[model samples]
Target: MARLKIADNLDGEPQTAEELAVKTHTNAPLLFRLLRALAGLGLVRADEEKRFHLTPLGRTMRTKGDGAFGDFMEMFLGDQFLPWTKYVDAIRTGKTQFDQLYGVPYYEHLKKNPDERGRFVNGLKQMTKIFNANITDYYDFTPFKHIVDIAGSDGTFLINILKNVPHARGTVFDEEPSIEAAKKNVLDYPNVKDRLDFVAGSFFTDPIPAGGDCYTMKSALDFEDELAIQILKNIRNKMKSGTKFLVIQTVVPDTDEFHIGKLFDQYLFMLTGGKERTKAEAEHVLRGTGFELNRIIPTTYPLWDILEATAV
Candidate 1:
């Protein structure tokens, strides 16, 4: 539906499959079958006249909306979905199948393919909007005056944080692709426009911007311990002692009580040869990189949390 733009064409008003087929440019017979399937899933309902209307649930598939999941569905089930075919091979070789198939890491793949990159970044923005909505409420940011979001993509999370922290300014540290995207994203938030800055560089090679009392990395340290430690140490060397370091990502539960991170860990491995860590695993990496893990602050969202730390 997303690929054909069928969902976006649907309004609450009833329309027959032939009408939808005209808009979406698909065969009327095939469209009717799909519409019937959608109705089975409660995304739409057909009347006696065989005209279908989008249910509230179906409207979430629209490309443009406040709570739309169209991009999320498109990316996860579209671009990212292809890598799953290599899952068994990946497990056998302990490698990212995406890298094997595409001849580069997922991030590198994004750099090579502009169209896919655009979709991936937009999908991430949409996903962040959904998951990181309550992060500011869960963690206090008023005390920190300046925050530097390391490897912050498009600055969506930083912008969300700065919107809540009126007194705090922030800088988003990322590569050129993300910095370019962040430049455009920052324009949407006029209130925090003056306070946010985007710095383009790699945390592994470039000198991190100094003087921020707080630094944050949301889902940025999912790489192997050595690589994650290198990035963390780079930040540690640049920032002063006692500066707060917030690692805002999921820590796999020690117990077997189900959590999304358990499954997402495999996805991370597929994309970057990285895996989600348990609390102990996270602390081991942090401690090795000259930071002390203070506590894990839970957000309302199950998969998100703040791993509060201090540069020692």
Candidate 2:
């Protein structure tokens, strides 16, 4: 639907497969079959005349605009989806199958492929819209005058934070691609535009920018344990004592009750050799990394929680 721009073409109006095909430049017969399947999925309604009307649920698949997940769906269902094919192998070897299949880490592959990188970045941006909603309301960010987002992709999270905490300034420390995206995205929020700065570098090698009373790593530390600990140590070495480190990620629960993080844990391992940590697991990593786990604050979003730590 996203690839053919079906949702965008439908625009809440009923149209025959031929009409949709004309707009999407697809085969009418095949398009009709696709539309029929979509109707079965409740993404569209097929009338007696065989015309298709885009359902409200289907409108979310539009490639752009508010509440769209077209790119997000495309990313997960496209290249990223390939990693899951090696799930069994990954479990047997306890390795990131994506690295084996692609001959590099996922991020490295993205850097080498511009088209896939764009899709991945855009997909994360869309995901931020879904998962990071009203995060500021849940967490008190006003206490910190300066916040540094480590490996903050596209600065969307920092932009949102700065918007809520007007008195605070933010720095997004990430790679060149992400910094470039951040530059363009910050323009949309004129209120926080001037206060937001972009620093292009890898968190693994580059010295973390200093003077931030609070440092945040959102969806960043879902890597191998050694790497995650190294990142924490790096931040600890650079920042002053009494500063806070906020790890915005999911904490898998021990219970059988359903949690999205459990599902994400498998995908993280498949793609990056990472696992979504449970509370105890999260604290274990934070311990002896020059920080003390202060609290775990849950936000409205189920997949993200803020593990607040203090630099001792």
Per-residue lDDT tens digits for candidate 1, residues 155-248, read: 8889988999988999999999899888998999999999998899998879999999999998756887778988888899998889999998
TM-score of 1: 0.93
**Candidate 2 ranges beyond 4 A from true positions:** none
Task: Estimate TM-scores for all models.
Answer: 0.93, 0.95
lDDT of 2 by residue, 1-312 (tens): 987789988976789999889989999999999998998899999889988998889988988888898887877865688888888888888888889988999878988898888888777778778656577877889999999999888888888889889999999999987888889989999999999988888888788988999999986458788988888888888889899999988888989999999998888888778889888888888886888899988877777888899998
Query: How much lDDT does each candidate structure score?
Result: 0.86, 0.86
lDDT for residue 297 in candidate 2, whole number 0-100: 89
Query: What's the distance in Å from true for residue 278, model 2?
Result: 0.3
TM match of model 2 to true structure: 0.95
Worst 10 residues of 1 by lDDT: 71-80
